[model samples]
Target: MTLAGCVSTPHPEKNTTAIPVAPEPEPVRPLMYAAMPDERFPIPAVKLDQLDRRFWRREVDYQTSERPGTLIVDTPAKYLYHVTPGGRAMRYGIGVGREGFAWSGRAIVAYKRQWPRWTPPDSMVARQPSLQPYSIANGGMDPGLRNPLGARALYIHEGGKDTLYRLHGTPEAFSIGKAVSSGCIRLINQDVIHLYENVRDGSPIVVVPDPSMSNIAVSSL
Candidate 1:
């Protein structure tokens, strides 16, 4: 009975059926966004607390051909979903471009930045000459709580060409679920921070144009 030299490999349970236990849903934390997200930035700390609960970030059941790790932005629905395994997604409220500024297409997250500085484009400076001070020539707006770009920015690109669009955080929580931005997609600071931490660079993104194309899913648990 010399069993010391023998090694056993347990066979996988090939005949067993898989029973998927759904994940429990998490509640949206009230102050996660509006209050001070970080101790360093003090200017926009208090505004997000007044934001609507529906706009808060949460996980939900979803349906789409886009595999897990793909990000979908439903422009008309004012929501962005990060697809996950087992028919689930993490959804975040968003503010899109107003009217003529709205656009829909495919793009990839080319890069990401934390507390990014914003330089007013030449066209922007032309429309609001006062912004000239923050133009490329002036070194742009310094990254801070008061900056329009907010806590994080995900640069979107298509076929190696810059789309000039961004998924970014904003201090203005009131803008969530509305069409108000010049063109960039906006989220609450806390939500954006969460997204920035989760998504990997070069992930594919899909922007569905109309509400009819949106597929809303409920969260389990």
Candidate 2:
């Protein structure tokens, strides 16, 4: 199926199964004002200027490699590196998994969506029954402040099934360089927009086990 046509599909057999395929939610409109003509957020830009420049610098890098378009995320450094030819990579700052949310493995950008809808996993809903109302059947939440997925989402999958993990955008700019999400990695909205425009579906994504001691050296000025 074409990427654009990969929204939810009904499974008729789901009716008899214990795990009901929850009805797909309605489309959500972004809560933030639309991106302006210049692509800046409608809201005030986050005061990144006050934060440590080293942190921002750590987020991006370039590494030349034989694998062509492979991207790597060094969770310890809170950086995502997009590998380029000739031993260079473009790196971006990222927010990684919290203590219990950390995941390490190989995955692919199975699908991507612009302004994707937010759907809490069934496990989450079970823990917080109050969330049941917001389950996918209720058309999910209108893309707004309450939504956790932010403005863009790149769904990651392994072995041809959704890992339920994602590389998505976040309104909480302060979370960069910190571990404080369910499982997916988060990026600043502006940075995610930049990444979304550059990466394609099915791209190779390798989330390294840990960045602190990993010897994966990347080269770039």
Candidate 3:
């Protein structure tokens, strides 16, 4: 009388049946280039449709041996990449210097400012006598929408010296993705504000050489 009472064999209907899963929702991309009325001088929205999509500020896959938080400015490509974790970067379109004026080398973000003053260097004032009023002695141009440094400016320094080169904003949005600045790297006002908020003092930045030039010297701002 072994197990005499009752015995029942149980079996799963089918082990191959898969449970239904909900699909993942698409990532939401914020409109980063929008207007900011809260700013001291209300910032207008960028004309995105007029600008090339490649030049837009966005995160991208960046292949580099450098550590995270490093900034690499690719002169020829007109791209400035702030390296983020996980082999990614926040890339922004930048305006480099024209023919005779260009800067390259590794430096640190010595300091940054919001709505920074624009002091035309003596060399620059010499070239454009009209800028004499904004010379360093005049306490530089007051921070405003019309200011050359735009909404933000990051001072670049190397070997414990101010390189006089800066990563700054420009009211001339069209200047982006072009080589027309005196020497400093320029970003659109909106983009500059975004970058200024992210980068910290002492962050490393490397402005690569422009291969088009015969001699890539680290020039002044």
Candidate 4:
């Protein structure tokens, strides 16, 4: 008694054996972007590489003393957490300032902007002469895909003074989960749009300083 059932196999006719298999209807490519705000110039959807998924935005169980809607940036881990009521937080991948360029402190998202304009700071212009033309006088880079500030910006302020550190969007999706910014925190464009539409202004922002640079306790977050 053969316990394994014998599978029937088809024998190809030697006389006419070429069975044409219909080529897999090319896999439907997912729509990269929705209707653009400007019909003349559409925003192309960012094609994500497999590596990005490892740092992709996601919601996970997170225990924190902070209340809901709190924004905590983990500079070391390159992750930002938006605390929720429950023991959960929505986390996003981010790019932070490089070694000497990093800063840390407590601040608030005092203001928000959509398709915000960007003017390179004088200091930045001094560093890069190319940006000299776009200083406060000449008006900075016009808001668009090529703009370093991708789609939105969350102004960080403390005691009514601008920290010059922003939580903003970047067209450079590949920069996620890395240290490569002037001093601001950068998220993927699509990720920022999702965050901008949800995170409220006045939300608390705590920039977690790079531990290698400074010992700022972030276990609380």
Best by lDDT: 3
On TM-score, the leading prediction is 3
**Judged by lDDT relative to the true structure, which candidate is superior, 1 or 4?**
1
Worst 10 residues of 2 by lDDT: 212-221
Q: Residue by residue across 1-221, what tens digits does model 4's lDDT show? A: 75656875566764556688987453332342233455223555555652266577788999988889989998899999999877999889899987777768788899898888899888889999989778998988788777787788899888788877888887676788888898889987777877888888899987777778643322222
Task: Tell how far residue 118 is off in model 3, in angstroms.
Answer: 0.6
Query: Model 4 TM-score?
Result: 0.78
Per-residue lDDT of candidate 2, residues 76-105 (tens digit): 888888776666776777888766557767
lDDT of 4 at 35: 31
Q: Estimate each model's TM-score.
A: 0.77, 0.71, 0.83, 0.78
* Residue-level lDDT tens digits of model 1 in 84-171: 9999999999998766555577889999999899987888789899999899999999998788888889998887977778999887
Cα error of candidate 3 at position 83, Å: 0.5
lDDT (0 to 1) per candidate: 0.81, 0.69, 0.86, 0.78
- Cα deviation of 22 in candidate 1 (Å)? 40
Error of 1 at 17 (Å): 68
Lowest lDDT block of 10, candidate 4: 26-35
